[model samples]
Target: MFARDSRLRQWLGQWLPKRPVTRRDSPATARGGQGDVDRVRRQYLESEQRFRALLESLPKVAVQGYDRDRRVIYWNEASTRLYGYSSDEAQGELLEDLIIPDAMRDGVIAAHRAWIHESVEIPAGELELRHQSGELVPVFSHHVMLNEHTDEPLMFCVDVDLSDQKRAHRDLEFATRFDRLTHLPNRQTFEADLDEVLDGCRRRGLGLALLYLDIDRFVEINDALGYEEGDRLLIELSRRLSEQLRATDLMSRVSGDEFVLAFPGVHREDDVMRVLHKVQEVFRRPFGLEGHKRSITASLGICLFPDNGAGARELIRNADVAKNQAKLEGRGGLRFFHQHLHDDLVRQHRLAESLERALDNNELFLHYQPQVSAASGRIENLEALLRWEPLPGQPVSPQEFIPVAERSGLIHRLGDWVMEETCRQRAQWRDAGVKLERIDINFSGRQMGRHDVFERLEAHLRRYRLGPREIGIELTENVLIEADARILEGLHSLHHRGFRIAIDDFGTGYSSLSYLKQFPVTSLKIDRSFVRDAPGQPEDRAIMEAAVFIGHRLGLEVVAEGVENAEQLALVRDIHCDLVQGFYFYRPMPADAIERLLVGGVQSLGSLSN
Candidate 1:
């Protein structure tokens, strides 16, 4: 069954079977034949309606037909929906005017003409076509030529809307390379762009300041509030930090609570400081954290290109080292990567590499320093110290190698070795009948963060046949201030088990009094800086007075550290300090040397006694 159009009817007639019923010999035969012809006609009409329905119903696929002139001869409902044109409005319109963008019109027309006349197939491809409202629409369009080889060939186009696919692809790419929370370039993109930016700088002989910034004590903030609040804080911080950079600068979110920035064309220290100060100002202003205003600060690490590092990884690593240095020197400050600093890092790396096998090689050992009573000059207990000797006459100071071990994640191993050796030494002293009240082991803040720290400590003591009372842990004031719930809880469990906890190097750190009081502390060690001048200066005397008063008030033993002279000892004695530690009493010595001192009952340094 042909459509209502005469041309379609003529075309269908050539393809359909006809049952002709003319005057026949029998009327019955003729009637039967006419019924067959009627049935055939009805079937043809149904097929035609089905074909038309299929073409019109496609929601995202538009089908349009054109004559040799490239004018729209047929436009289905999908075409109307896709191009924002009614079928009536699209019919008789030129295909170029209907959907071809101005820039692509000529190429589209040429491709159509070649397909129509030269029998060349139009390549099916994606295109940005113009919508009726002047917006661009993405489409995957293909062609179908009907009645080809005839004088009046008709070409039908099948166009699929590709907007959804393209949009999805774009979103996936963005998610891969950006921080979803802050919508900033993430580590992957940052490293990639850094390489490109470094190349440009190399070509132009330009210098840049690459700064790595870390939000100090961010873990405490995250734990005190929640992760959602943490994300909000990071988003706001990114916004504020972004406002501090020039258009030429690049910034990226490298990790949680950490950002890396690059300032191009900044070669001089003055220029570097300018950008550094701008970043610092961002933190000086208080932030609204969880609906409460809180002052936040960051440690900034700077690395100058071509001076500090030669590549992206090098720069990032060096910048991180400088940032860590700032954090170590008390945060909210900046440190530059000097050549000497890089050399020191190289040495640390070497040391760490060496330390990986130091335990097996027996290159590590422990020394004991005695802490004595300030008033009677009687030894109370010994402080265990760690020492390293990589080679003969090549002793590496704990000050240098301890940090190297911590950063290399070898601190845990070193700490285990220290504990085992210290316990072994104490057991030896006990067997020899040399009495020691208890010995204290210095615990790193990093080591205290272990989730299984309590179990590990208990296991160590059990292995040594020592109770918690025979061993104690010394922590720094910074450690107490920065301890999260887990660490503080771990400390409380240790303290509850009768392990004495002392805050080492007190009054020399940015320890919050609020947080300090919450720690399970039994003693406070006055920092050497205050005691070094306490015997002579009024300010130092005042600081020592306040420290001792606060410590005793809290039921903690106040010990004056770095008491190297008689005057300092007498002053601490007057201040009622419970213990004294420094070279004035006994220098850190090998276990054998210290054992002799203990077995001989030589507790006090009589030469230094007042």
Candidate 2:
């Protein structure tokens, strides 16, 4: 047995015992010994074949075996498929030369030597492997050390393909960084790029320009043409803008109809202006949307690094401030960040802060402007206008604070307050035996789009014991044009609840006549622009007359806004306008003063009718 053990060890490098002759060295013992030896040999061959079959059957995983010296010993078909190498080419080749990239060969060889000599295990995880085609293939590798009794030490790597996973991850990343509509970098990626650019500019002490651009009157285009058409126009605009930008510069669509451009290193402020002028020139041509060639302009706000701000957030905020200033100054213009712009923003912030407390401090009040009937010239309806008188300061203009409220998301609470207050005042007038016609209250787009507006207003009416007919909801034309289904449902629901809907600033928006027909509107208030010059301008008079004619034909009342003189009033009345609201008949007055006028029983407002 000892001799047999040594001989088998020499043959197979494995220790095996020789079975004793069970029949005391007879013929039976010899036959049994031969049978056992033959059985052991056959078992080894079968196990080897099974292992080979397993490697061959794996269609998606590469099974490669290498020696301690990192030379390839075995390469399966899957290995060939993955690495673009045939078994004849891969086998007996150095693993480093076969799969390891030039930069990683040394490290991989060292790791393999450590695993072989020191019994240190190679850590298994996902990594990229180089294919013969020079393409990088992602794979999750599982390593096994084969230390068979008869065979030399070997390392086997079973790699599962991770190419699909990596591709999916790349696609997800792209979707996250890009906007679906314009296929441009979205706000997140844009802001990140801005931060990176700002850091580089700061380090080099370079002048950088950040331009914030808003498409002028984009809302009108969106309302006039459908949103689908608007999307096409935006795509075309993006293409045009991209054609004008340098490859080094970054342009991103930060918001709806708003884009951001970053110039990391500029020689002078004039360079920034030159780039902006190029951008302006890009939009000089019209973009054809739905067969209509519509011309659009951009309002640009420029802020310089190291001058306006040193950081990303500060620069963006200041640029936004300058942008709003540009819009206020006039559209189709550009403005640089200035200290006064910052001061104005500070003032706006202060005003917003005051407005938050104004409602609580009872500083808010409503002034009613009577909308008189054109036929009898008597007070028919009154429009409730909001006023704010914060203590220790002059009255804040609604034009200024209202926009602030809208931006700061305070419009929701402010609008609710105004609605509730108007309702309460109307209830007071009723209790005082003063006849109150329908009081028109303005509704911002924010208010109209709210899901809870209907419920909130219903509660207010119930609280004041007022019916919906006692008041009206006035919204600008853009509100109806941009209204989603939820807002439309809300409007229709309000109309069904006996609430009157008025399209304020009619003819000022880009909505087609179809919207006027589709919406449940009770009146169209001709915008002040037409009424302001109707007495002289033929175009103005023609528009005014058309507005009135359309209103009457649609079974809706027409109210001429900004009627500040007898001549304008006479012109609107001659055009057969149903109602007139402006300073000419009665300026916006306090509730008590309006109550006096209501109680006076005057058949005419002021001396216009008399």
Candidate 3:
């Protein structure tokens, strides 16, 4: 190859000889072959100079070449521009010395050795390049094997500064997948991670567990301590949970006060129990926020891979079902997925569907229980109660159906039906010359929490052409425990519109006297549990007395329910209870029967007498 290149140069030098003469001298007359050689050499020198200037003028990009032994052969101007090193400085330096970080030197060397032996092109991958100014810049490098004869390798590295790109990517990822307040993974990320883990478990024959956790009474804490303190407490709790879990565990915030943890490779039930026990211990410690020492508890439900479910949706559903069962069993508990829970869920689903059909089928009916004035012994009002009559041979109690209705979002329909029916009945009675004072219907906590309840009530009143004063809404202490401001506003609006509000089943839950005073309550109904044993059990008597006094102190009338005997009635009368209702007065009867009793003065009930 050298001899060929030399002979070509000699022939070029002879053809283009360097001279001061121009076209004036003919080719044959010019200084023989020597003139041609000189002319060719001059032309070659000009072309070489032009090519060198063009390469230098372009942008700084490196083209490097190395042998199979990893010896540097060429370094372009771009290398100098990027690494603050000239060609002279990089000529003898090993390629590894220029691009690889000190910690990754051994790995780079091994990778290069493998590439040389395999004679394969290793495309650009991540590497750190040390600049002359001592700053390490993250870069991508490409290595290529160029020669096959002597096992020589040619490598070209194109370094791109990725610090800004990395920062922007991380920020975007955080915004998309993490909660801002607690720095925990959010629902979107949690679902994605759960799917990924479940897929892997299926492929690898591994065991996976998912724990769904919900903080008990978190709303109460938020309401009692203000939102700022609540936020602080949540942040602290998230931090504590992160600290307590293993590094391999994945924890995420799926909703308000609800979290989900994915435990990978938990082969045994004991492993799951141990992790849950540790979590319980962590939450058992009291949290001190702004001088208030408050403690919180979690109700957790667990579902395992290939046992409870195989996919993300099924696993989450089973876990949620178990969590609900834990809550139903009481707070601060844990439950595992079982066949019975699945069956119960299926039954609930069917019941919800049937309830939706019930409304359309006109199977819901109302029964009226007369409330008699204690002083006059005359029926002053009638409480409207709902009854669902399923298909033939199926009789379901309100206790069993009401909760399902509330959970399945069917309460709104149920409430609207009751309201319209109550108003229509009252209007019918007035038109028929039967004097009924008011019709009180119960409202579920879910119904009371709805924003559109006032509009619904107004619409129903207009539909029936009934006055708002003739309709009353009864709510239990559970409604107040929710303590939603929207609910309070709704109650106030109803009150302003001349609708009376009654607190049903009072003294059965955590009734705060101070908060109760602020409510626009017109009456309080003592719980039947307390009334059932009243005038006999001392505790029941004391509770009944305190309730009557509290109601009177608040300037609200008190009604005693479930008064089955004369002794109970006399005791309530002595306490100055304003109204009494129970089997002692009358069982709930159909609307026609109630009207007959109203017209006949209670003598028409001989057939239903106990």
Tell how far residue 421 is off in model 2, in angstroms. Answer: 3.5
Candidate 3 residues lying further than 4 Å off, grouped into runs, are: 1-88, 91-212, 216-277, 284-296, 302-322, 325-342, 374-377, 391-393, 481-498, 511-518, 535-556, 563-578, 592-603, 606-610
* lDDT per residue as tens, model 3, 247-304: 6778888788888888888859788888787788878789986697777888999998
Question: Model 1 reaches what TM-score against the true structure?
Answer: 0.75
Between candidates 1 and 3, name the one with more favorable lDDT. Answer: 1
Per-residue lDDT of model 1, residues 529-557, tens digit only: 99998777999999899889988988999
What ranges in model 1 sit over 4 Å off? 1-43, 56-58, 71-74, 106-110, 176-249, 268-296, 305-320, 360-362, 369-380, 391-393, 424-436, 477-610
Model 2 misplaced stretches (Cα beyond 4 Å): 1-46, 53-61, 67-72, 88-97, 100-130, 134-206, 216-243, 246-248, 264-270, 285-296, 327-333, 360-363, 367-385, 389-399, 406-415, 428-610
User: Quick one: best TM-score, which candidate?
Assistant: 1
How do the residues 283-367 of candidate 2 rate in per-residue lDDT, one tens digit apiece? 8898898897878888889898888887777877888888888886667978888988899778888888899999789999999
TM-score of 2: 0.64
